[model samples]
Target: MPANPTLYAYLRGEILPYDQAFLHVSDLSIQRGYGIFDFLKVENGQPLFMEHYLDRFYHSAQLMELAIPLERSALQEAVFHLIDKNNLPLSGIKMILTGGYSLDGYQPVEPNLMIVQQPVTMPTQEQLQKGFEIITHEYVRDIPAAKTINYSVGIKLLSQIKAAGADDVLYHQGCVVSEFPRANFFIVKQDDTVVTAAQDVLKGITRKNVLEIAGRTFKAEEGTITLQDIDQAKEAFLTSTTKRVMPVVKMDGYAIGDGTPGPVTLALLEELLKLEKHSAQR
Candidate 1:
């Protein structure tokens, strides 16, 4: 047998070396790009909001019609085991369910489950305060509720985003704002109401927490936000597992408010950090 590897992955009912985790080429995920995934952050040896992530993961599997072989409890146990084995304190865990090997290479079979751990670094104060810019695109995701592995459109626009001097792309449909590629978008109205899209967007875990935190101090609502609404907005920001609360200073070459990280955005970030610390303790 080979020697023990440094990193490990939970794949197909086994904890194996990260490099050894493999899926057959005949898998529908490879042939038809059929799969779903959910990612969550781990801090100080604890998985943050694991229950919520698991809930979404299972929901995505159900939507994709991929049956996860492991029970919820068993999956949770495997996740913990993988984390303990890898021993990465500040990291992110990715849970993936892929359409398994198919006889015709186009049909779904027994799904393959994979859990991987990778190191993660939080944004520095300078990076957070500087904020970022986003270019707008007039497109919406198919099956927006499920967290699938389909990112072809977003990935294809990388060149356009870089050419436009932006960090990411904000998706919209018929002038109605939706979400970013991997993040949820929120805009603060002139009246201090924080609004995010209510329909046709993935309900992100970070987005959920931000809405809850913002509601305590502001009028937070899940409703339609349009390009026109953004034009009259006071400030804007995004939330994701990696980007907890990142201010959006510019959109399509115009400044959002004063073109800097707004006070409300900064305050929410602080509260989110505190909440995360408390969560780690629990």
Candidate 2:
């Protein structure tokens, strides 16, 4: 494995090394995976859609009935502090809030907020131009709307996904396609109709922006989608904070359309890249 560069973490009002921050083992998050987290990107010290990510984090914490120990303003300031402390030019930020220490298992107290930064590399130009393939598996996300720490199902399928000679996996329950392991899925048709799974998956910030940008050019519907529907579409793609609008050339053992990144997928990706660039400038 490659050596991950050391970065700073903001815990409460103190700044510490990423690996030194510690949490108790008796927290509900440790015993029952009762925690919420958010991922945001920092470009040239600017956090992209930071407020949106924080809003989602607040919502998720509320859903889990976990009270964040720090105020929103404080949290934002901490993130900026860490960014400056690390002297990071560009990086991905992950904020993890777990229910903090307790005397007994299954009990909760205040939440633990950890902000970490790491250098990242995006997919190659060839992978972006040609798109990537994925396999479909039978798995469902529990409380998929909340970005929780538990990822057992996704973890178990990692080997299967790799063995299929693909980039990732899309999960399906019966005929209804749920989502990818870490991204949302979308399908486009020859008639220019775009279909995607509704609120059952993560409300990805990037996914929302791409849909808003492409809504003028394509007809998008948010609803239940089937594996057969994916196979029938002219093109398919996955969206997330890290991958943005990633084209999906194949699903399961079947090729999407002609087994190539379709025109519509490429167009949306181009528009998304422009949006990303503009966002970074702000």
TM-score of each: 0.97, 0.94
lDDT of 1 at 157: 95
Clashing pairs in 1: none
Q: Across residues 1-282, which tens digit of lDDT does each residue of candidate 1 receive? A: 333468898888889998798888997888988999999999878999899999999999999899989999999899888888888879999999999888898888899899888888888889798998999998889889999999999999999999998999999999999999899999999989999999899999999999999999999999999999988899999999999999999999999998999999999999998888877513
| Clash number for each model | 0, 0
Best by TM-score: 1
Candidate 2 lDDT tens digits, 163-182: 98888988888889878878
Residue 20 shift from truth in candidate 1, angstroms: 1.0
**lDDT of the candidates, in the order given:** 0.91, 0.81
CA error at residue 211 for candidate 1, angstroms: 0.5
Clashing pairs in 2: none
